[model samples]
Target: MYRLTWFATNYDVNREVNNGRGPVDFKISKGSRDKTLVEFKLASNSKLKQNLKHQVGVYQAANNTSKSIKAILHFSQTEYLRVQNVLRDLGLSGRRDVVLIDASPKASASTVSDFNQKGFDF
Candidate 1:
């Protein structure tokens, strides 16, 4: 969770804002009063696949803004591939409103070499 004060000076950023449908993750208001909705997700469960298809769009309409961002963090290669496939399925793979981040720790050269020795690629 982020504190509003972190971005209040630049933009009025609030978390867990319920516009109508439900509580959105965050909403940041620009100088023109247009709100930019942001949602964060961790690729952990099966439901994430279904949620990614429409959650952000629902929040955007509820918040009365066309601009939004869905920030998804992948902690492993499996999670990363799942998100990638879901985005491609939803036709949002290259959309500007989507922000996918790789949060997995990198494998050291030694670790990669060990994997290669075992006929695996890292």
Candidate 2:
């Protein structure tokens, strides 16, 4: 998905890029001087705390760029709270560089009848 989005643009996106330090999830760059690292993780991951602490910094150093983004997906409310706590512990709360995605399943709009139907003409 990331690759497809950046494919048409001048940016180049690569996954699991290894630069000696270790392989990062994704690397988006237009050139050596313009590079950004993106790391994806699950909220339920066992190493979530450790990864949130030291992973991105190492990747940035290895890739020679200080710019990076961390994205974590939570499947439930509990997982979301857990991620929040972890981020708080790591002093990264409310940071724009860290993205928290809620991937929990939801009921379809058609199946949900709580909407105001007065404006519709079915």
What do the candidate models score in CA lDDT, each in turn?
0.81, 0.92
Residue pairs of candidate 1 with colliding backbone atoms: none
lDDT of 1: 0.81
**Model 2, TM vs. native:** 0.88
In model 2, which runs have C-alpha deviations exceeding 4 angstroms?
A: 109-122
Instruction: Report the lDDT tens digits of candidate 2 across residue range 1-122.
Output: 76687767988889999998899999999887999999999999999999989989999999999999999999999999999999999999999999999999988777867466646555
- What would the C-alpha RMSD of candidate 2 be, to one decimal place? 2.3
- TM-scores of all predicted structures: 0.75, 0.88
Clash pairs detected, candidate 2: none
Top-scoring candidate (lDDT): 2
Candidate 2 lDDT:
0.92
Regions of candidate 1 where Cα sits further than 4 Å from its true position: 1-8, 106-122
Please report how far candidate 2 places residue 105 from its true position, in Å: 0.5
